[model samples]
Target: MTRTLRVFRWSPGEAERTREYRVEAARDTTVLDALVEVQRSQDPTLAFRYACRVGMCGSCAVVVNGRERWACRTRLGDLGAGAVRVRPLYHFPLLRDLVVDLGPHAERLRRALGAFTPRAGAEPYARIAGDSRERAAIDEAIECIGCGMCVSACTLVAPNPRFPGPAALNRALTLQLDSRDGAGAARWGVLLGEDALARCHGQGTCTEVCPMGLQPTASIIRLRWLGLSRLLRWTG
Candidate 1:
């Protein structure tokens, strides 16, 4: 089937341009398949990122037609339209067509200074009791595959670049509940900042776009409660 792909093109070399591309794509083909056909058969300069097109990699994510989803997982036939619009992640730096530079976000998580800090060089590992509240908290968002579909759909990140967004905050929530994770002030420090949980407006866009069904807004709320508790304790 011949369909037009409304591709958003941009790079450091070119001033950013949007062009519609008509390509012959098979029915029931995924958006990734259509993009692959366009790149290999149509335009060599087009750029997008994908690996393990089975939706496990989370690299083929893009804003398609207006919704944030994984291209590899989204079927083109599912879209009732003559054209499919593809754009880079809303909040990240545009590297090129459909590809956004996620390095900064990734880097921030690595430097978050939590989950790595042990408590006073204490016992080998902090024991996590099966029925403990912290243990249950970790289980809430531990299934995140890091596909970032939620982050792309997040309105907070789109308007506030400093917001650590859903991914990092989710990670923090996982650690916050981890009894073994010796993160005290460090975890709250990173999670409560502007780029962290505080920036979330509870719009629930992240949860809606999450393919894994993880609730980020819930995690943020938990973090808020944890922060308030911590602050109250410190003052008292």
Candidate 2:
């Protein structure tokens, strides 16, 4: 079977354009597979990014048919019989066709203090009970692969670049809930900033487009609530 892919194309200093390519497709063929075939047999100059094509790496994420999806995981058969529209993830600098710079995303994570800070004199190998509240709080959010889909779908980052985005805020959520992490007030300070958690309009676009089934909107809400509780206790 043959399928048509309308892919976004551009280069540094080149006018952006969409190029269509026809490739042989099988029932099990994925968007990634189709792209590889196109690059190999159709257009060798085409560029994209992918690693661990099994969907664990989250590197091959692209906008497919107007929604963010992992190209490797999205099977051609799953999409109706129409041209598959492939484009780069939005809200980031485009490097080339179907590839965007993730540096801004990483910067937001850094601003959110996404790294874990060990508590002073804490146990070297402390174990958290599976049923503990801290464990439950982050269980659903810890699997994020940093694919930038949520960031691309988020509406706030474009207008206010200072907003630490869904991915960064989601990372902060996991670390904030960690009892062993000593970031404490320092982390909260960033989350409470006007451009950080407060900028989230609760649109849920981030949650809707997340490839990992993570609820970054909910994570932001949880962080907001945590910040409020801290404020109340401090005042009391």
TM-score of each: 0.87, 0.96
Report how far off residue 44 is in candidate 1 (Å).
Answer: 1.6
Candidates in order: C-alpha RMSD to true structure:
2.5, 1.2
Q: What C-alpha lDDT, on a 0 to 100 scale, does residue 80 get in candidate 1?
A: 86
After superposition, candidate 1 runs with Cα above 4 Å error? 122-134, 193-195
TM-score for predicted model 1 compared with the true structure = 0.87
- Model 2 Cα lDDT, one tens digit per residue, 141-173: 999989999988988889998999999999998
The TM-score of predicted model 2 comes to 0.96
Clashes of each: 1, 0
Instruction: Please report the candidate that would top TM-score against the real structure.
Output: 2
Q: Which pairs clash in the backbone of model 1?
A: 164-195
